[model samples]
Target chain A: MIILSPLGWLGRSTLYFLAATGRITLFALQAFSHIFRPPWYPRELFNALMQIGWLSLPVVGMTALFTGGALALQIYSGGSRFNAEAVVPQIVAIGMVRELGPVMAGLMIAARVTSSIAAEIATMKVTEQIDALVTLSTDPMKYLVAPRVLAALLTVPVLVGVGDIIGIAGGYTVAVQSLGFNPAAYLQNTVDFLEPLDIISSLAKGAAFGVIAAMMGCYFGMASGRGAMGVGRATKDSVETAAVLILAANFALTGVFFSL
Target chain B: MIRMENVTKSFGQKHVLRGLDLEIPRGTSMVIIGGSGTGKSVALKCVLGLIQPDSGKILVDGKDARGGDRDAFLARFGMLFQGGALFDSLPVWQNVAFRLLRGRLKRPQAEAREIAVDKLRRVGLTPDVADLLPAELSGGMQKRVGLARAIAADPEIIFFDEPTTGLDPIMSGVINDLIREIVVEMGATAMTITHDMTSVRAIADNVAMLHDGVIQWTGPVADMDASGDPYLEQFIHGRAEGPIEAVR
Candidate 1:
């Protein structure tokens, strides 16, 4: 019985995971289809864009800046052991543009936007506002989820581009001022090392991560149970799920873009 | 008119509605009164298509409620939710005019706002309260705003869920009177779910007592006290010892 119990528990867990994945995939497909349909709420879309994109700038900027600086310092120290300290500029540029910038921005958004979206929508569900929308002849999927997912999809790429520039600037500051590297030579090395494909992959990853973050928030919210505990759980699960999915997606996207 | 025939719904092991049957006539108010957790709200939600029944037929105006253009079907009805359910982000007027400002009922912003103010006035709110968010309003006022929003589009049918659940007796009386007056004036068919006998007395043209997932007693409001069903009698007198078991 004990050995069979372990198998039972594993099977139950696996089924639960599969069911949740199916629900989220269906929700994402519905929201994406609604984006192409008419009767779109421009006002709601604009509000979402401002909240997810413009409001997220400061945190995303700070994360990328610090991560860029620390990446430079770590690479320089490791390179010094091999007498390869001069490779810092190229490595920092490639690292920030290809990987760190988008992932960091996505994680920051997963923390900020995903939690907020989940809490707000879950509260609405608990209060019966979602039902009210349906009674008013508005499709909650189109009215609520589509606007948010679309906003995140459109703006996260822009945020990634901004983050990449800011991150390179952070590395430049650390290398030139503290590490005694020449300013013009460092800039030239950094610029020369970054290819257009690196920037495109970063922004592409940003868009994918954004969709995952917002979709997780909406899915958990609509599926929330009944009260304060339900809202809290939805918000917590949304951020955790979004962060993990963002990391996993970053790996897959990187493999697709850069793998030999 | 709305009718539910043998509707059944279960959430996991707990069956909320079991073969529930009901009928409400057009241009009349039907109040369904029951103890908490006896599936009154579930029945109401089923009629509105918010919660689908497991096995049953729901008819609105002799047409199957489940088969039709959902939006067109929904467009004929208005609902005032228990907690008001006003959008926290929108101002009072925008919330009131939500239907008029969007979808197939779209109107110019100015015209929608004017109609919103008119509906607000009908619900005893002033135009000055139009710009305030729902969170800024008191609970009773929020209920009034919800009522205003419900009738904003002049829907043919209106449903009120727990219209006086959380209010002082005076406020409850006022809301009940308003509900009764609005139904009469609008000449709209109304269905209300509540446990408050006072609300039932004030708002019902016909009353149905729901217990054990079925209608226990149903008759005109005047015949209620004399109908003499044990469940209805116990519920009306507020006695705990009866066919209905108190959860606690």
Candidate 2:
């Protein structure tokens, strides 16, 4: 329902946003608490691990490889403008391990896993499976949400590490094969340029982004309305929300790790 | 026994359940009948603690039904959902054995599967069907599987929501007969909500007619035809010219 006055409209919109934030925060807290409690379902957790982690590797790997190749080319050309083409290995290595690697992996999973989780859960709600779960003495948060969120939190960081290596390899292949760079020199420069902190921060961002993605999916799914349209809306909204949150989280994570 | 007193629930401006009261005796089958959107499901959900009425005192066996350990409270009840609501990812046996395989009621895997198979046979399903997913079964088979799951735990109280909503006439009759046999044989307390008169006749020991968010009429099923309440008559006869407007 809309109000006639602009002030009223603004107030209503603000209140709605605040209420939504409160609900999402409450759901996230409930999931966190349930995860620590007993009556755990190891089977559901293993299923989630395979779905969210192992199944996501191919897409994450391909995206990182192409991105790494493109980034190497762009950095080489840009550096040549300043007579600094020799900086290709250093810049590509740092750019990938520091930023692009985790962000890309997170965004990719957010698109794939988040949307699928949301749609499936929303459909279950529509079909009364969630209520059925409740009636069967099973909590939806424990059976459905905890496993998924925990699996994502554990797996996305590993995916990010794999993506980082593949991406760097792609850059190395491109540089040594086509850019007229020494294969040994390129590998040496890349090896010498990376530090442990860079990789650690990348994975830290991965973990944070993973939590955002899976949590958003479960929240939107559980809160979905009725009917087919409702399930569709939840799916669409989950991806959009997860993508936005991942980017915002990436920015905050970067500031925390590299601001100094 | 289940007793609901002065239950009132509202969603926005629409009052789905307004000051509704009902009493169902133990080991008796009570079926609530109403037109669509007349709060039948809402009332049932309230009793299950699936929906909380804005104000009400629901007593299950003389104890207040609200404010207790939810899992412990829910353990006493089983429900057959309108759409079957079986987990697509789970095999039929696992779905039926869900309660037995986990939580406070956990049974050994082999024992649980044995129970699930027995229940499936009781519902006219062959053991061969137990390994199939819900999606693999026909609608009637799915409904049978759901019924088996509902009674698998031997719950003292069972609820059926629109048990025959989307089935062919013969299948519906089969389900109705099966439900009647289960309730009579087990002597379990049963509450069902349905507009299907065939289902009502086959399943109800007592009948309650809901209209305008209240029980317009209620009595033993044998007296339903001569109840003399206009609302009940209008609904049972499916008359569009009665007090209820065709347009909401």
Candidate 3:
């Protein structure tokens, strides 16, 4: 094999990155295009919703609750240094709604749903089930990718909304039970401080992250090479790509929503 | 009828098919025989539109196979994969009726199930196995299910990819006979790619040998034994020494 110089290696890496990006963008566009087409399968969409949204509640909920509880304690201690421990409710609500809730939910989904989707599709490919689908005159994009992507796009934002509520409740429970904060006052403070934009931004982040997670899975899956090793690599790569893209998407969505 | 002219395909630098030409007439069974990795499957996939040729013309019934309404084109054909590629998620009957239960051929749920059971019966599967998933079936059983699925849509053409690859000797013979009977009964154009010489003899109306990315020999199955093409003779008689290279 010819050894590449540093510049050559860098150039090769750049080309690979661009090619991967182009493939993902096109796959996402095709998936979205099939969403509005006729001959839609409601059973598939519902199954996807159940798998991606409802089944994900336990993990996303537990993450939010624990994070919210921990945040309450940390902020209280940090605020005590300034004699402002009473700011716990407002800070916790804003924190979960503005950033932590959506980001954490997205990451959890990237890990769970993305890996699952990639492995399933890649395995189907290895067994030639995808080709069987084509032979049966069914479009794999519409049957596989479209339902999952559309379901994630619609349901993830709702999961974010649920996560936000659960997270705030966790903060409330910890404050009222352990920190001696008045329950009614804490609730009122949380409600008063959280603007609609905070919720909107959180949901928007969820939608963007959902699309990234799903599209990454489909792209890596369809682009998988061959064999058992290929399926494993596709699963690993999909989760990595989904997680990284979810975080990057979170940052961009945050900028769009919160930066002034 | 299906015809291919000057078909060429390569993945990166490794060329597979090179200026290959083939013609398959209507209502005949064509089996392409080649050594492992000799692009026999690739050739079948190219005609099935599962893969595109780098440069070629593939015509079916006087129309170009590619760049058409894909669903309409695909609906006219059925394929049984090498590994039996049954959907692990669906029961045996559902897998058999996969093409009929959805898409433009959507049948009512009960009607689809009935058709699936009927196909399963035709494939010699018992009614008890209809609700069992593919993982629950034996390899021979899975192949039968796959064969059932291949005939489900009753398409004008059928492609079988290595249909006897993983079966036992007796099972392979059984499957070979079943395939022969099905082709005879359906009167559908059939294309099969395999390395098994017994399978070649059993299911082929016509035989073609692919070596070095081109058709080395083509003739009626009876003529295959005495075609006098060295490549064909070496391959059919199972000689260690041959014109075709055994390894890359």
Candidate 4:
């Protein structure tokens, strides 16, 4: 019995994980269907967009700026060992556009938007506002989850695009002002090194990450237990799950776009 | 009219409602009283189709509650939740006019607001409170606002869950009287669930006692004191030494 205990624990954990994954998939599919259906709430959708997109700009922009500068500095320092310091511009541009920008923006959003969505929705559930919506003949899925998911889906990619440009600019400022690199030459190298596929992959990854973040938030929230503790747990779990899924998705999307 | 026959619900092994049978005739008020967790809310949810029963039938106006267009079915009902459950994001008037501003009952914003204000006035609230958020209101005021919202659409049936749970005696009495007046004025069928004896007395034409997942006693409010059922006697008299186990 002692020896089998470990196996039993593993089996239970695996089952729980599978069940959670299935529930999330079903929820995502339902929310997605509602997005295309009638009885849409434009006011709710616009509110979600403002909250998840317009409100998220400063943090995403700042993170990208600092990250790009640090990337340029690191590449320059390492390349100097091999007398290849000139590779800094190309590497920084490619790095920011192909990988760092979307992932960073996604993680930031997971921290900001996912936690906010989870806490808000879980509180609503606990307070019976969700039930109130149902009694009023408003489907919570269409009024709440669909609007949020759609907003994140439409806006996160745009945020990613913006982040990539800001990141490249950060690298440019660092290289030109502090590293004694020629400004025009640095810009040329940066632009020349980035392919169209790199930009597309970045934006695509952003969309996937956005959906995961919003879906995890809504799923955890709808499944939240009762009381303040339940709301707190939902918010924490949502952010953690969104962060992990965003990173995993970034890797998978990278492979899809660049493996061949 | 609403009816529940042989309704049973269980969460795992804990049966909340077991073989429950109940009926509420049109244009009458029925209040179910019970101890906490005695399936009062569960039965109500089953009737509203918010929760499905494991076995049994629920009929609303002689039609199966579970079948047909959910929107149309829901349109006939209004619910005032226990905690008031006003939308925190919307203003008082918007919350009150929620039903009229959207869906099949859609109306112009101006018309909806006007109706909301009129309902508020009927519920003893001022029109000045319209633009304020629900959080700004006191608990009693919030309950009144919820009541206003419930009657805003002039639903044929209204359900009040613990209508005076968190209020002082005077406020509770006020709310109880308002509920009674509103139901009578609209000629609407009403169902309320609460353990508050005062509220039960004020709001019920017919009274039902629920215990052990079923109706233990039921009759007109006049016969409640003399019903002589151990559960009903124990619950009404607030005695801890009767058929109910206090530790539960």
Interface RMSD of each: 0.6, 0.7, 0.9, 0.5
User: Which scores higher on TM-score, 1 or 3?
Assistant: 1
Per-residue lDDT over A1-260 for candidate 3, one digit per residue giving the tens place of the 0 to 100 score: 25758779899999999998988888888999999896677888998999999999999999999999999999999999999999999999999998999999999999989999999999999989998988898888998899999999998999999999999999999999999999999999999998888888989888988888888888788878799999999999999989988888888888888674
Model 1 misplaced stretches (Cα beyond 4 Å): none
**Per-candidate alpha-carbon RMSD to the true structure:** 0.8, 1.6, 1.7, 0.9
After superposition, candidate 3 runs with Cα above 4 Å error: A1-4
lDDT by residue for model 2 over A40-130, one digit each (tens)?
9999999999999999999999999999999889999999999999999999899999899999999999999999999999999999999
| Residue A259 of model 2, lDDT score | 68
CAPRI band for model 3 = high
What's the candidate order when arranged by decreasing DockQ?
A: 1, 4, 2, 3
Candidate 3 vs 4: which has more DockQ:
4
User: For each candidate, what TM-score against the reference?
Assistant: 0.99, 0.98, 0.97, 0.99
| CA shift of A254, model 2, Å | 0.5
- Taking the tens digit of each residue's C-alpha lDDT, what string does model 2 give over B27-88? 99999999999999999999988898999889999988887788888999989999999999
Residues B130-170 of candidate 4 have per-residue lDDT tens digits of: 99999999999999999999999999999999999989999
lDDT of 3 by residue, B66-144 (tens): 9779889998898889999998888888899888888888899888889888888888889899999999989999999
Candidate 3 clashes between residue pairs 3 or more apart in a chain or in different chains: none
- Give the count of colliding residue pairs in each prediction: 0, 0, 0, 0
TM-score of predicted structure 3:
0.97
Model 3 chain A: ten consecutive residues of lowest lDDT: A1-10
TM-score between model 1 and native: 0.99
Give the docking tier of candidate 1.
high
User: Tens-digit lDDT track for model 4 on A102-221?
Assistant: 999999999999999999999999999999999999999999999999999999999999999999999899999999999999999888888889899989999998999998999899
